[model samples]
Target: MLIDSGSPGAPATIGISLTINGEVRELQVAPWTTLLDLLREDLDLTGTKKGCDHGQCGACTVLVNGTRINSCLALAVMKDGAEIVTVEGLAKHAGQDGAMHPLQAAFVERDAFQCGYCTPGQLCSAAGMIAEGHATSREEIREAMSGNICRCGAYTNIVDAIEDVMHAGAAR
Candidate 1:
């Protein structure tokens, strides 16, 4: 049975398996279904925001197999069998103690967000960057996080928050 893509045109469905937020989900997705839509529309993981929807904005960022990727640019079928982590998953993975991830907490402490629309993408991207272990300095973090646009102009605070987490992670 074909499922509606929630768009005006109901596209044909293709089966895909995704391990999302530590849960294995098997679903039928349209060939044109972007990973962002799959998460927000199909799975209802709305934490991963869809800002530009054209991959220009990093609002749909998520981790796929421990690497940061713009979910808007990826097709759901292309990520079959891949491990996906959205903001919700990152929060859950950080601690079962019900505390926020260090980066998330740092963001708040540093006032890294204004309107908060880009916070999810920024947090996920920073978490992934820390996992990548390639960025160690403030300048490096700035460069690495350039893809995520915070229209609120909180770049300095965002970098500060990310740096705080990176240093803390290093200590642990």
Candidate 2:
């Protein structure tokens, strides 16, 4: 809970500790601060885009405790002590100095990102979806990834890229 600072309007900040991109970070955040804002504004991790600002667009997707959630819809303080992963962390966890994550490599190989605005969210969402191990086929993948939208109309290529990684068993 946020306490008023005894003033007319400023709400006191609450301390939150979140493990982001494998780094443990302790910070203060206002109760109303959204995870997207905390990541982009406070932490300067702008890889997670803020599109629609509502839950409809998957542009603000991020993995919290290994599960994908819409960052824009999530309160930063609510995820205190949680482990979060963004697009920037995927490659680092992929095991090498310059290697890209399988999904990242596949997306590049298949030209999955056109305009690229939705790529970050798509990548994070795909990573989380793959980890869930629910998408078994092309149709299933499409259904599972339906929550993410690409305005550049890269649906086919995105699906193909994800399918490639999924079939190659490179993604967990």
Candidate 3:
């Protein structure tokens, strides 16, 4: 339930519960707060990048219920109770000895990133794309990943890394 402030047109500020990065969080935010701002500003999860901020660049991509969405375009109040997976959450088992997610490892192995500003969003989007089970070839991966813009010209390496992961069948 949203409780509005006494102001006439103030965006309702309400408490919302979100399952983010495998953890449940309770937060009070304005109805207009974007999920990206909630993650970066409030929660301090800076992995998701803020690029164009207009949904043109996929830098704010995050997985909502295993589906990739532009966090910048999604209102936090609307996603209350939704399960979100940020780049930091892509690897369920990761530590000094634990293995990283296949995509993560592939990205490193193939040198899929440069400057790294877009790496987080690219990683999250690729994870969700892999889970969709539609990309079967390099071309398919490229097409599916068209939304994510990597300004470093690492498209070839990114495609190669995704292909490697897909071939290994380790998207999950």
In candidate 1, what are the lDDT values of residues 52-156, reduced to their tens digit? 988777999999998899999999899999999899888776654577778888999999999999999998998888888888978888899988999999999
- Give residue 164's error in model 3 in angstroms: 0.5
Give the TM-scores of the predictions, in the order they appear: 0.91, 0.93, 0.91
Q: What is the TM-score of candidate 3?
A: 0.91
lDDT of 3 by residue, 15-36 (tens): 8899997899988988878999
- Alpha-carbon runs more than 4 Å astray in model 3: 1-12, 93-98
Candidate 3, residue 62: CA error in Å?
0.5
lDDT at 52, model 1: 94
Question: Which stretches of model 2 miss by more than 4 angstroms?
Answer: 1-9
Candidate 2 per-residue lDDT, tens place, 1-172, comes to 3333455667679898999988999888888889998899878999999999999979999999989999999999999999999998977765646788899999999999888999999999999999999888999999999889998999999999999998898874
Worst 10 residues of 1 by lDDT: 1-10
Task: Show the lowest summed lDDT stretch of 10 residues, model 2.
Answer: 1-10
Residue pairs in collision within model 3: none
**TM-score leader:** 2
